[model samples]
Every structure is written in C-alpha cells, then in structure tokens.
Target: MSRLLFILALFLNTVYSCEVCEPCECNVIRFRRRFLCTADCSDRDLTSIPGTIPSEVHVIDLSYNDLHSEDLARLKLFTGYLTDLNLSYNNITYLPAQSLSTATQLNVLNLDGNILEKVDSTSFGHLKQLHKLIGIHAKTFEENSFENLEGLNYMSIVFGSQEVSENIFSHLKLKTLHTNFKTAKRIPEKLLNFGIDTLVDIYLDVPNVESLHENTFSGLTILKSVTIQTEMMQTLPSNLFHSGVNDDRKMPVNLVTVMIDGVKSLPRNLFDKQQSLKHLALNNIEDLILPKSESQVDTLDLSGSTLYRVSADWFTGFKNLRFLNMSRTKLVEVNNDTLMPLLSLTVLDLSYNNITNLPDHSIQSSQNTIVAFNVSHNQIRNISSLNI
Candidate 1:
C-alpha cells in the first residue's frame, strides 16, 4: 500500500510541474528569464491578469486588455524590480490604490485613455523614485493626488471634454505639464501655487474662458514667458501681472514678455504699474484704446489688428520704446504727432495698410534711431518723398 501511494504522489507532481501557458500569441515568443519571469500579455483577450506572476519579472506589457479596478487590485503580489509598466488603452475607470501603493520602485506608469474621474491624493506617495506620470485624462483630481511625490519631474493630463479646476496642480514640483481642456471657464489660481517661485514653461490652451480676473497670475515670480489662447477673452484687467498683492502686498517683477491674441481692445491703464515689462504683442485686435499712464515699454506689436487710426499722444509715455509693429491695418495716413514721442525707437512695421504716402516728417523724427521700416503692400508710389 505504501509503494502504491508514493507512485500516485509522483504522478500528481509531474502533471502540474510545467504551468500551462495561456493560448495567446504573446506567450509563444518566450525569452530567458533575467530575474524570474518576463511576460508579454498584450493584445490578448485577457479579462484579468493572472495572480501568479513571478516577482522576479522586470518588464510587463499588459496594454490592450480589459482591465478594471478589480484586476488592478491583484497586483499586490508583485515584489520584483518592475521599472516600466504600460496599461494604456484599457477599460480602467479608477485606479486600485492598494496595488499601486505597494509597487514602490515603479518609475514609469502609463494610464492614458481611461475613464478616470478623480485621482486619490496618496495614490503616488509610495512611489518615491517615480519620474514620469501619464494619466491626465480625468475630469477632476483630488486635492492631494500628488501629495508626497517630491521626486516627480514630468506630468501630463489630457482630459476628454472636461473642465479642470484651477487649484488642480497646486504645490507640485513638476518641470513640464501639458493640459488640454474642452470647456474650462476659469484659469485656476493653483497654477501659480508652486512653492518654488519659478517654473520653466507653462502652456494653457483652454478655448472656453471668457474673462481673466485681476491678479490672475500673481504667484509665479520666476516665470520667463507665457502663452494663453482662448476664444472668449476680450480685455485684460489692470493688475493682471501683479502677484500675491493681497497676501504679502508685493508684485511680480520678473516678467519679460506678454503675447495676447484674439482680443477686441485694450483697456486704459492696462499696464499701469508693470515696471519690468519688456515685450508686448497684441494681434487680431480690431480696435485698440490705450490707457493713460506714463509707463515704460521696450517693445510693442500690434500686428493683424484692424486699427484705423491711433489718437495723437497715444505713444507719448513710452520714452524707452524700441520696436513697434503696426502691420496689416486700415490706416491711410499717420499724423506727425503720432510719430513724435518715439525718441528711442529703432524698428517700425507699417506693412499691409492703406497708406498712399508717408507723412513728410514721419521719418524726420526717427533719423538715426530707426533702422528697419516695413511699408510693403501700401499705396505709396514714390520713395524719394520720405526722408528715412
């Protein structure tokens, strides 16, 4: 009886020795195990990942599957040195908090194109060495979703027809961020809430914003350049560049250039106290009204605006002005006083207008300071009448 029992036990062990590989194409292309196992379960009809994945596996590609929150919860057994994880193009709606928090050494996490709505604050706290995060398509984010990730460098949030709150990205230390919103009505104040006081680049491409409140960008002191595109903005508030005026009673002075397109007109005293402003570009404006102030501006661009005529003394306060662009307007003639206050002016662009002739004293006031003049596509027939 003892010999018969031993033979039955040996047969049972041999039957289950080699695990049956799932009938998928990814399992056919086998490779040597570096640590324990490396599986390619992508493009298979996998409803859920097998719970027995070896901990020694380093690379796992589980993309193009029907994974959900429940399936992701089974990843708590992963104890290997997983550095890269691809879960893109899945049917995941919410992230499994327990599984993700246990994967401490995960560096790259790709969760794009999911139906995620909110990200828990402590979801990424365990990944101390995480470098990049690619899951921004959610409609909104929890306040603390990026609470303890101090080592994170890059993040991208590509939402699908959703509106993100202004304070969504506050207190993060990321160097680069790309956000696309469908109907974002307001620019959240949290965008300027980085505690570092400086950012490399920020691109805001919201198309539904209509108005920008005063002190909209008051926190970013070390910002070098800013580009904003929206369909509803028509004017700029007076204290738009002044940062944190209510809290510490200080202003942002490091701003260098401001480019605004698709506005109808500019309010009076638009740049009242912006002392450090250097370059300004205003395009696609049909009519412009200058504010009354003695502010100093270095460069100005009014290209592609339908400006008919600028009132005399319009540029009287800009004594340190250098470059001016007035290309593509409807001006037929410029008065002598309109070109009198530009003492330090150098470059002037008057192309694509209806001017038949240059004023007699237009170039007389700009003798040596003016170097380049673009007057193409105009009605000026003679070039000798003007003293450029």
Candidate 2:
C-alpha cells in the first residue's frame, strides 16, 4: 500500500536523524555534521567531562557529577565547539579565572545548586559568547559580578544577591531573568530597574514579599510574561499590574501565573490595570479565593482549590474568557449567573470535583461557543439546565 510505504519512509528519516554515542549512551543530533551531543552524565561518579567525545559535539551535560576545581581544565578541549554546558547540582565550590579560560565558545551555562562562595570577577570573562547563565548561590555574586559578561541576555539564579548594584545589568542586553530569593523578604528595587525595556519574562520566588509595591514593574514595557510564587505573601497590594507612561502601556506582561501555596484570600483590586491579560493560572494552592477583576482575562485556571461560593460578580469582567478549568476543586454548585459573562468560553472543565448540581441556565452563555464542556467525575444527575 502507498500509505504504509509513506509511513515507513517517515519513520526511517527520523531514526537516522541522530546517532548514539558508544560507551557513554550519549545522543547526537545530526546536521551537515553531528551537532548537538547531549551526554547524560548525571549520577556518573566521573568527575570530569568525557574526553573521548567527538570534537564536533555542541552541547554537554556534566551535571550531578563530582566535578571539582581540578577537573575544570579538562573542558578546554571542547571550548571552540561546545555551545551549551551544564555543571549544576555538583559539589563544586570555587570558579576561579583559570577554570573558564578555555570555554571560549560557550553560549549558555548552568551552575545551579552549587556552593559558589569564591567566584571572582574575571571568572566569566573567557565565555565571550555566553548570553545566558543560571547559577544559584548564597554569597558569591558581588556588586559588579556580571560587568564582564556584556553579551548576557538571560540568567536564572536560585538565590540572587540583594547587594547587587543598580548598574550591573545596564551594559548587558538582558531579555529574561529568573531568581528565587527563598530566604529574602523583599525584591530589591534595583532588580526591576535592571530589566527596564529589554526583559520579556521575569520569574521570582520571593515568598516573603507579603505586599507587592505599586511601582514594582511600572517601566518594564517589553515584558510579556511575569510569574511569581510565594508561600508567605499574605497581602497583595492594589494596581500590581497597571497602565502608565510606558511606551507600550496597553498591556504589561500579557500573562501572569502564581503559585500561592499558603495564601488564603485573594485581594479584590489586584489586577485593576491588567486589562489585556491573556492567561492567568492560580495553580496548586490549597486555599485560594478567586480575585474579583474588572479586566477581561482570556483564560483562567483555578485547579486544586476550595471555593465555597462563586457569585455573579466573580465572572463580571471575564466576558471574553475562552477556557475555564476548575478541576480537582471543592466546587459543589454551578449557579446561573456564575458564568453568565463568558460569551467566548470554548472549554469548561469541571472534572474531579464534588459538584452535585447545575442550576437552571448554568451554561446558557457558553451554549453557542463551547466546544468541550466536561462535567465528568461529579454527582451531576441532570443536564436540563445546559441548553446546548
């Protein structure tokens, strides 16, 4: 059959697209020549990069190894070719200048979960092509630690420095930044200023900032996504995302995701100026109150929460919302006006809940646009209210 022959040809093309390295169980993604070679050396007791790898290998995963300062010299041979390197989750302590002199072509580096207590200023100078770096340290990052990495556009630090100077990111072309200040109480003002006009995605895990300042992200004109997770954030201030004098003020960070593990109540005016918000997810929070917003967010997911009520005002401004996911919650009722404003809702997932009844006209607004209205795993014994 021609159809069977076509499938076979497609399978063979995929199988021969990459080769596996012998003795190391490494994968090689081939181009004109073999390019990306990811050798999963995790849990391997070997302390250094595999010396037997082909020189054309472009990426290497040396994570979870016992690599130390003495083994840093072994990476020099792959300097001209290797574009991405991972040295995270290792027992490495120090990153001296000599350790990086040979990584001439590295573009991305990860040093997360390491004890970098003595990295100096010149330690990153050799990585001229490096534009992204991920390191989580307690005290190694100095005020001007990133002055030499002018090409860096992205960075993720598990425990970033509070003492970082204001202008450390001024000379760089940074576009994305992720930091988890788990122990810190507040995000330093200098941190937001660092991403003035270039940052697109900013992720923070500062649990202690109970109330976010109104001017926290006022000037980040180009940001498209902002995610914040906090267990101790008790009070969320008003106008957290608002329009002001930025060049692109119509929308600031079109999507917002939060993981409030310990938050109990949602503030009413949290998203006053966030009219253009596209997607919002309040994931995995045991106790959460859906914030009453006048802004029309496109998609909203409130999975794994305990909501005892959903008044008509709860769905007032979400008229254009397309997807509503309320799975695995303690919702027992769907009142008539609870979802009346959702004129464009396409998918409604109420699965895995204690929902026992759907009152009259419960889904009347979504009867015209809904493609998937899932009410499985509930005590729903009637569908008389669902006119669709």
Candidate 3:
C-alpha cells in the first residue's frame, strides 16, 4: 500500500499536475516567493485569449496576439486577480466599450503598436487605478478619453496624426509627458490650453519640426524641465521658448533646464529675453552661433560641435555664469583672455578638443575663482597659465 501511494505521487508530479497555460501557444512563468505567476501569450498567432488561463496567474501578456472582443471578454473572468494588461501590436483599430468594465483594479495599460486611430471614449474610464498609459500611433484625443484616470502620472505617446487639441492634456495628474512625433511640422499652438500646472517634465522629441513659433509653449504655468530635440532646424523664431507664468507662486521663476539637440544653427538673440533661464545645453551642431542673452545662465554646455575658436566677448553678456563645457567641439585655439570675463566660473571643461596650447592668460583669469578645471583629451604642449 505504501509503494502504491509513492507511485501515485510520482504520476501526479510527472503528468497529472496543471503546470502549463493551455488552449494557445503560450508560456507560464511561476515564482515561489516574489513574483506572481504570469501567462505569456505574446507572438502566439492567437486571434483570441486562451480559454483556460492558469488560476494562479495575476499578470497576462497578450501583446502580440490578434485579439478581438472575445479575447477581451475573457479578461472579465479573471478581473479580480489581473492588474496589468498588455495589448500592444494586436492590430486592433477599435476598443469595444465596457469590454474591461469589470477590471476596476487594472493599474497598467499598454496600447502601443495598435491601430489606435479610433477608440471609444469610455474604453479607459473603467480603469480607475490606472497610472501608467503607454500609447502609440495616436490620431486624436477626445475629452472623456482619459476622464477616469485620476491616478495617472506617467504617459508617453507616439503621434501618428497632426490633429492636436487643447483638451488633450486636460484633467490629468501627469508629472511627465513624453510626446514623440513622426514628421510633425509643429506642436499645435493650444495643445496645453487647459493650464495643467502639475506637469514638470515635458519632452518633445519631434525630429522633423521645422520651426518653433514664439507662442509654442505659451500655456505652461510651471514647467521645470524642457527638452526639444529636432532635426536640421536652422533657426527658431524669437521668444520661441518663453513660457507662461505660474500664478501659484508669487516670486519669480525660471525653468531649471533647457536642452537643444540636433539643431544646425541658432538664430541671433536665441536666448535674449528670457529672465529666469539657467542651465543651457546645446548639442550635435555642425556650426556654433552663440545666442546673445542678457539674462544669467549659470551652466552652459556647447559640446559636440564643429567650432574651432571661442572669443571672450561672446560671454560678456552672462552675469551669473559659472559652469562651461566645450568638450568634443574640435576647438583648437582660444583668443587671448578668451575666458577672462567669467569672474564667477568654478567648473570649466575643455576636454576632447584639438587645443594644442593655451593662448596667453587663457582661463588664467578664472583660476582664482575656479574650483575644478578639466582640459584632458587635448593635444596640449604649452601650458601657459595652468602650471601643473
């Protein structure tokens, strides 16, 4: 009798136990202590959700399936345990209304790589606890599309259409908005007309944007970090980056950072009128045209350019200038007293340049007020002012 019991246990362990998710080409991942079991049905050529998902599964991956209403309907059965739903790359053009209404606990939703040119407004309202929304190929946004997403904080969308609107960003609590566009000529003038002050990090990664208008970013109230990476932009119109004031704070405020990448040239007076602008980083330019700004920028980076020389008079405008970076710029020579005017400079990085020798008193005027100076990766032979 004992031998028979042992044989039965072995049979159960070998073939009788339910260890795999069935009815579809899938993989079931189980964790003993930390991870909840997950059903991965990605890239399975499945037109519908598997009929039999493991009962212990708390996460499902249907990202690459040709899912339809039937697949989504299966989710209502496991709504209690499932928190994440990945429907990316499903070739889905429309979302059936209330298909996930029972999934009130859905927290993360990824709709990337779908034909999301059309969608029902209330398709997302059922996900009250949803925080992160990753979308792709967006055509337009209706007002009620994101109405119930109160806890939403992180959102990144890839634009497939130029139909921008004011209500698109309204009534959300997003801290960061990363909008990457393909061949978008311009960001609609009133994209943020609702005055969403909670947004702090706004990244516009539209490579083909030709020009920036003076009122491009006019409605933002409290934007702290701004990054605009474009392709072959010759010049930006004046007042292109002047942002609106935040009424919540009585004191003056400037954006903590501003980064410009992949621009070929800078129009004169590019940074001229801004009051609170501080850190400025210019990258990946074939030519260098320093903008004339009377306002103070404590940190300035002119790296990865084709410039060969720098003049002292070009920096006389910055009053509170401190940090300067000219790395990887191929600057071989500096005019006499080229860096003498920066009285408050502490950190100067001239590494990765073709500089052979320092011109007389080159940056020597700043040694007393400077803290750390890096001139490594240069072809330096004469150290005129820097003794060591």
Top TM-score prediction, candidate number = 2
Candidate number that wins on TM-score, 1 or 3 = 3
Local error of candidate 3 at 315, Å? 3.4
- Per-residue lDDT of model 1, residues 266-292, tens digit only: 776565566666887777776676535
Q: What is the lDDT of residue 104 in candidate 3?
A: 71
Q: What is the C-alpha lDDT profile of model 3 across 317-356, one tens digit per residue?
A: 6657899998999999887667767878889899999999
Q: What's each prediction's TM-score?
A: 0.61, 0.80, 0.68
Off by over 4 Å in 2: 1-22, 25-28, 31-43, 160-171, 243-264, 283-296, 376-385
State the local distance difference test value for candidate 1: 0.67
Residue-wise C-alpha lDDT for candidate 2, range 154-183, written one tens digit per residue: 888755444444454565667888877756
Best by lDDT: 3
Off by over 4 Å in 1: 1-161, 174-180, 189-191, 199-203, 221-224, 243-249, 291-296, 382-384
Clashing pairs in 3: none
Question: Worst ten-residue run, lDDT, model 2?
Answer: 14-23
Q: What order do you get sorting by lDDT, best first?
A: 3, 2, 1
* Candidate 1 TM-score, C-alpha based: 0.61
When superposed on Cα atoms, how far off is each prediction in RMSD?
A: 11.0, 7.3, 7.4
- For residue 117, model 2's alpha carbon misses the true position, in angstroms, by 2.5
